[model samples]
Target: MERSEPARHRGQTAVAVVLRVLAAAALSVDAVVHARLAPGYQAAAPGGLGEGNLFVAEAVAAALVGLYVLIRGSRPAWVLALLVAGGGLAVLLLYRYIDLPAFGPFPAMYEPVWFFDKTLTAFAQAAVVILAAAALILHRRTRRA
Candidate 1:
């Protein structure tokens, strides 16, 4: 049992590293996409204060979260990482599949289209969500152990 401890530790470290890298890469992709789309979205907006600004904010948030997780591997970092990913994923999935009506102030967000931007964002966001969630679970398990 003692002889295999080092190997187990190394394996766990490798898995954690892989998860971090995966989550970071996905966040980067999504962030760039949002940044690229922001100007166009804002330009086409009714008052230039709708989805476009939201995109910019999301881009910044994603970058910060990604950088934080990529640089530091901690349970708190993982929790934040998953929260951002999960929130973005929820919005994307909802606007993709659901025909949501307009909220109190927000316009109806029923974008049932799958262009290159949408496709890339969905893929990257999904990856980030999955990897972040996995990393969080692994972290919790390690803490308990």
Candidate 2:
């Protein structure tokens, strides 16, 4: 299949791709900040804000995904986005299940607030991932048909 869109739609695709790249970059930055600045941050520890290796992994993955989106178009981008989103969801769930209670003072010590923040961020990431994936899939189908 040609997999091409109308010229008018091309602009929209470009914008979407740029936005996805930027979003990935922003996430990478966030991970870096958490890993480097957050005190007591440990990958293995429950309460740690961020771990060095994990943050590096996420940043690298995100950067590569963003690059692929920009250079190769939507399908690969969608797959990478899904992986990134799933990772976020996994992190949130892990925090909820094991980290929240095991390493925390519960609702005290600002743990509850942090938990809510992370949860919301994860949800937002998942939403973006779903939207991008859907857009790519729909575009592909339309092009094929």
Candidate 2 lDDT by residue in tens digits, 1-145 = 5535586477666666665665565445435443453344443445544354455556566566656655665666767766775675676556555544334422212233355446545655566566566657666764774
TM-score of model number 1: 0.88
Runs in model 1 lying further than 4 Å from the true structure: 1-3, 46-48
Worst 10 residues of 2 by lDDT: 104-113
lDDT of each: 0.82, 0.56
**Candidate 1 lDDT score relative to the true structure:** 0.82
Among the numbered candidates, top lDDT falls to 1
Q: What's the CA RMSD for each of the models?
A: 1.9, 6.5
Model 1: clashing residue pairs? none
